[model samples]
Target: MKTAIYEKAGKITVAEIEKPSLQAKDDVIIKVVRACVCGSDLWRYDENVPHEHGDANSGHEAIGIVEEVGEDITTLVPGDFVIVPFTHGCGHCDACRTGFDGTCDNHPGYQNFGNNYQSQYIRFHYGNWALVKVPGQPSDYSEGMIKSLLTLADVMPTGYHAARVADVKPGDKIVVIGDGAVGQCAVIAAKMRGASQIIMMSRHADRQQMALESGATAVVAERGEEGIAKVREILGGGADAALECVGTEASIDQALGVLHNGGRIGFVGVPHYSNHALGSTFSTNIIIGGGAASVTTYVKDFLLDAVLKGQINPGRVFTQTYSLDNIDQAYKDMANRKTIKAMVTVD
Candidate 1:
């Protein structure tokens, strides 16, 4: 089997390794069809950590066909197409049954599916928890729909999670920080939430255009005080809610700075630095919320209908794609900002 290994910061390589086999009664094997690099992957890249040769299974965003399943895996079988949410969960657990799939109690908490999914075949533990069956067979949709389903594994649902947590509502002014894949989805998510005005803070020319295509009413290409001023000026005061999709002290401050006194702010970016404005949150009545999104449980709400109806193009955020052999290049391009998001066709 071909697998992607996080050998160290700034390096991802394809290596042949032992193929995964069922280790648990509910385990399943997926022939990964499509997988992509995530923004969080860059944290390891930037830290420049020298992970020893062939050390870690790093990717989680993927969708594929079930190649094999344990006898206990009743919800899925060989040939079933499924979306592997970044946050895998026990579908039948109380938290997952409700909607808090991120807090699923039956699986390893907060960690992704064990191996790097950017591979030819990967073992998925607790097949039922890790796999969300596609509404129909893979052939049932257009090529673009398949790409849309890939985003449901993580970025799309994550973006929608920010909106849901912030309680974005109709006619409210909304601002989204960061122009990465999730932030772009935040633009679409806020629009889906019925926000009257969608404001995006982005500097990348290509991503700015994607934001517009995703339904952002306005895009700000400035930063620091200048950018905040521009967005506030556009809003004529402050926004009703802001989604902090970039996990940085600076981005967090910007999100807080551009909100109305009693507004809401939801953040989904994996935190890099502590939010620097705890005082502002204390004084202002900003309703702060957001954590990892439960894509496994909430996919139907944010991605399924939209993809099935062809109403949204979350896949457009995948500006480029590569074969599994080029997994290294895929990660490099995404890490260097040469691509909005990179997808790999694993098969």
Candidate 2:
């Protein structure tokens, strides 16, 4: 069992390690088929964020075949193909019932087993309630379909969360901050939710093009005040809603700058801002909402059908692919912005 290990900044080494197995009565072990490097993973690889060095579980999003199922797992079986969400919870919990599986009371803070998804196998907790079953095996779909299914594990659902929390409505105008995979998916989400005008803030041509193809009505290539000005100019004024996909002070400020005084902001970026940075929203009557996405709920409820029906192509964000052995290069490509997103094929 080989897994990615974070040695330090700019390095992700693959090493043979113990394969995971059922650790609890409700757990299942999955043989990973397709996985990818998430934008969030770069925090450690690029910024050298503090963590236990040599962490084996470096990646979190993956789609795989179920090789083993626990006794309590009735919804899935051996050989069932499934989408593995990063966070899940007991289906009956209040938070889970309300589509906030990330905040499940029974499995608080639950995420992919060991965050070791970029590997040959992983133990998935809450298997009975969380894993979303695909129609058939991985081989049943085209390469493009597989890539699209993989996005449901994290980025696509995350982007949808930004729009869902922001209350994007029909005929509404919305601006999306950040041009990463999540931002691209946010464009798709805003369009799907019936937003009439979708403004994507992106400086890269490749990203801007992708955003347009994903349904962004306009693109703002500037940053800071310049970017905000562009978005407002395109919208003819403040937007009805803003999606904050980049968890940074600049991105958050950019989201706030393009919205109307009483507009709403859906922030899904990993928080890296000062506590007081968001306090200013109080004076503007702006509504702030969003957190870890309800990946499980969205996938089961609608996204699965949307993907299967070919209504959206969120997989377009995966502009590059790598083998499991070349996982280090995958991280480098994403960290260097050479690829909008990196997809991994686990052999």
- Model 1 agreement with the true structure over 1-347: per-residue lDDT tens digits: 88888777788878889988888898888888899899988888768767778766668888898889988988887888889776767777887787777767776465554657878887887667657888767778776888888999899999998998899998989999989999999998998889999988988889888999899999998888898899889989999999999999899888888988999999999777764556557778888877778887677554777777887889998888898888788888988899989988876
RMSD of each: 1.8, 1.3
Best by lDDT: 2
Q: Can you give the lDDT of residue 128 in candidate 2?
A: 91
Q: Give, for candidate 2, the lowest lDDT window spanning 10 residues.
A: 48-57
Model 1 lDDT on a 0 to 1 scale: 0.84
Clashes of each: 0, 0
Which residue ranges in model 1 land beyond 4 Å of their true spot?
92-94, 275-280
lDDT of each: 0.84, 0.90
Give the poorly placed runs of model 2, Cα more than 4 Å off. 275-279
TM-score of 1: 0.94
> On residues 1-347, what C-alpha lDDT tens digit does candidate 2 reach at each position?
98888887888988888888888889999999999999988987898566676565778899999999989889998999999989876889888888888678788766634678988998887789889999988888999999999999999999999999998999999999989999999999999999999998888999999999888998888888888788778889999999999999888878888888999999999879974565778888999998989889999999999999999999999999999999999999998899999999998
- Would you estimate the TM-scores of all the predictions? 0.94, 0.97
